[model samples]
Target: MNITINRAAIESIILEVPDVAAAEAFYTAAFGLGDKLRFRASEEPTTGFRGFILSLVVSQPSTVDSLVGTAVEGGATILKPAKKSFWGYGGVVQAPDGAIWKIATSSKKETGPATRAIDDFVVLLGVDDVKATKQFYVDHGLTVAKSFGSKYVEFDTPASSIKLALYGRRAAAKDAGVSAEGSGSHRIVLGGSAGAFTDPDGFAWEPHLASQ
Candidate 1:
């Protein structure tokens, strides 16, 4: 495992699903994220939550509904409906391939008509020990952007790059409206410039060669 880069940023997320074609179709129609998300074929037995969530940060509540709506139309299971919350307006949905996604926006009001513009793509890793995993990522050359004790931490990543964050395992599960009882592989490989390595939580990463 190579972990020798400076200020590593996620270049892409490769989801290992049972059917790459179907997953590609679903994600394309749902998020329209393009090459930021990749897919491969795998039969790894992953049940319950996958210990991670692909968080889509949009500009407004309307956009949140737009993305969540398309996802549900594409066969996604809604865990949380879009609504206003203390943090903002958002919702949670599980993709057809069993990947949990949270679409949200800090803005409670509509700025304008809904557009397919995503402000940020954040990959939240649910770890047993947030502080320990935060240190592990720091050692792997990812700088800390925000830290709220051990409960939450967001890494500083390059602009237009996928961001990374950490949250308590059970807390993450609760946010996704699921139980923290997942087992087997995460079935998601994060690609970045940091070289190939597996985090303490068993999240695998590879050298990002291309978008596809």
Candidate 2:
């Protein structure tokens, strides 16, 4: 016999956009994302309902693709183009600032097996300098959280409430009790309908279809 319990789950990717109105318009026009919620203030975007809402919050710029050119010029590659994701369709671009943004649809459904447990997941980025990396995130849109010496810094996004930490790759390896192998050590696990990535440093991330 199986039992089911109702637990609140995280259902959206809260992305930091340069401009709220423009970003909103970009998704609507370019991807046909239906509008479900909005905010009067650019800083705080209030979302109604739960489950896979692609929440894009405008940062301090003017439009959705405002940073697109800068990102491409700064060695930022389009790891994945805006398409239908398990949660919806959109693109994932690494910003010149070293942060990857997933511009996608808010209507995508989440795909996962039923697990009785739930917890927040934190994404840690390996960088050469924590302070400088943290600064990059701050300059873009993410807010800086706690700092553990000059070796590490934490940044917060509105989506998960969990904090993403930036640290030296070697330091992160030490913390994980693994040798710091860098990006070369990472691997991608692509299954039939689900997939995850272990960046060269061996940090694992579970990425599902944006429209699963």
Candidate 3:
């Protein structure tokens, strides 16, 4: 089922890292997740999971392996090996700047050769309360596409745009293979249509002018 999604879509994410040049080099060599991502420089001290995860959903198992391989080669620490799960096949990696990323695909079998193509990009925010956060976003113009009680929530988005979702803090940490404890800045900024305000989980979103 589809909901009445807002026309104002999420543009890109600005990640604050200690070294912008290094991060850019790593990402460029890794997945090339597309232009939906942006970066900045900040030495802000952030520990643990940083309350979020960036996921790259691909076409097939070969694509998943391809992306994950380059990510590891680019100084990323593998949190989980690429393997098949009940839901699908995927793996997790932590960037040098302490960001967690999950490369995954719903297809277990590879139909063709591997390529650097991203079918979807997801930003999973770890919130304190899933249901309340879901309502907060809904109140701020986001429409829910999927809600699994208090466990998870996925917001509807336009094609080729950034996708957003919410998950419990502890669960998100566990999924990233990290401790569920962190303090200080999340080291992230979201440029989107939800207006200039921080969400219930301290995730900030700013109104963005659509790039020409």
Candidate 4:
């Protein structure tokens, strides 16, 4: 579907947690995501996976090792140890605040004609219904690049630094090897020019205004 809307690339993700300080420190020092990391404390303690995963795509295998090691040392649980895969070398870690992250580097040296830096970012949300959730974004003017039968979906968001994806709730949890059951608030805020709205799964989106 062809739909165009006035929107910036997804610039930042806000993760709500029970302990903002701990989450901030873990992301900043361990994942080297300090620049994009922001946190807010909940009125009460939070539990569960928070319904999303943050993916960091680096250019080198060594970078993946270093980042995963740092995350483990900083109190993250290694859900999947780093290893070589068909797509690349990657692993999973669950941070102190119950947020899961995937770190990886492509095996292919050259990506088509372009050779860019190693670091890239993506936000993957686990939704109750992938097709419906994807339709929700399409209704908001986002375009789709690839989609599968109610299992996975990815948006064509080249303008945004951080890409957005959706997956079936159980499928996502299975990929991360985490429990499918999650409770409490998701504690997430997606920043973009898409204006303000909440997805079917209750994730918030707001416009990101750049400073003059």
Query: Per-prediction RMSD in angstroms?
Result: 2.6, 17.6, 3.0, 4.3
Q: Which stretches of candidate 1 lie over 4 Å from their true place?
A: 1-7
- Model 4 per-residue lDDT tens digits across residues 1-212: 11134353576777778787788778777866544556767754456667888888887777777888889999999999998889888899988777799888886343343332346789999999999998988888778889997989988875435788999888788778788887877878887777889889988988654430
Q: Write down the TM-score of every candidate.
A: 0.96, 0.34, 0.93, 0.85
Error of 1 at 154 (Å): 0.3
Q: In terms of TM-score, which candidate is stronger, 2 or 4?
A: 4
Residues 1-212 of candidate 2: C-alpha lDDT, one tens digit per residue:
11112111112223344355654554343323232212122333322111111223222212224333334544556655444446444445543222334343343433443221113334455666677766755554456658887787765444433335677866654433344443322221211111343333333334323343
Give the range where candidate 4 is weakest over 10 consecutive residues by summed lDDT. Answer: 108-117
Off by over 4 Å in 2: 1-116, 159-162, 183-212
Ranking of all predicted structures according to lDDT, beginning with the best and ending with the worst? 1, 3, 4, 2
- Best of the candidates, TM-score: 1
Please name the candidate that would achieve the greatest lDDT relative to the true structure. 1
* Model 1 Cα shift for residue 71 (angstroms): 0.5
When 3 and 4 are scored with lDDT, the better candidate is 3
**Per-residue lDDT for 87-206 in model 1, tens only?**
889999999899999999998998988698999999999999999999999998889989999899999887778999999999999999999998998999998887889999999998
Quote the positional error of residue 170 for candidate 4 in Å: 0.6
- Residue-wise lDDT of candidate 3 within 34-140, one digit each (tens)? 45677878988777679999999998998888888998999999999899998789999998888899999888888678677888889999999999999988888
Structure candidate 3, residue pairs in collision:
none
lDDT of each: 0.91, 0.39, 0.85, 0.77
